[model samples]
Target: MERKEYYAVIFTSKRTDGDNGYGKMAERMEELAGQQPGFIGIESARDANLGITVSYWESLEAIKHWKENSAHQTAQKLGKSSWYEDYFVRICKVERDYGMNE
Candidate 1:
């Protein structure tokens, strides 16, 4: 099933310096996000300094719920304190989308 409208949360960030458990935390967060209500999909990429992740949801409420998740809150604090130098989150409405699979 596919929805004609949805929401996307785009997360862009720059790393502070080292691993400092960032890798494990990121993986864990992704895993946890997959279990959230209204979660549609996620795409992510990262290099040495920059990282960008986009998560899709069915509604703003679903996105909000994920943002307020307990473990996610802790990860946010850890990100600010130890992992990320800077970050930005953008929410966009997806009116239409299409893709082809080979």
Candidate 2:
């Protein structure tokens, strides 16, 4: 499919310690986000104590909805209280992009 203007939410974080249900929560969040409106796609990578997840959206409103989701709110609270040691979120507009064809 041809792509157009969109938004990317970049979430970068350093984990606290053990699993503590983080792995399961992360998987659940991904699954839930996929079912939300205007969700485009998501990409993630983790190395040792650090992780990066980029979720694509059709608009900022859609992003806001995802942020306000009750389940997501729970995850956010857990992230702050137990999961993440530190984190940063960056939202950017994708004006243009190009990549090799598969």
lDDT: which candidate is best?
2
- Displacement of the residue 34 alpha carbon in candidate 1, Å: 0.6
Superposed on all Cα atoms, model 1 deviates from the true structure by an RMSD in Å of 1.6
Rate residue 26 of model 1 by lDDT. Answer: 89
- Global lDDT for candidate 1? 0.93
For candidate 2, give the lDDT of residue 63. Answer: 99
Lowest lDDT sum, 10 consecutive residues, model 2, at 93-102
lDDT of 2 by residue, 47-81 (tens): 99789999999999999999999999999999999
Off by over 4 Å in 1: 100-102
For candidate 1, write residues 1-102 as lDDT tens digits.
446899999999999877899889989999999999999989999988789999999999999999999999999999999988899999999998876851
Model 1 backbone overlap count: 0
lDDT of 2 at 88: 100
Model 2 alpha-carbon drift over 4 Å, by segment = none
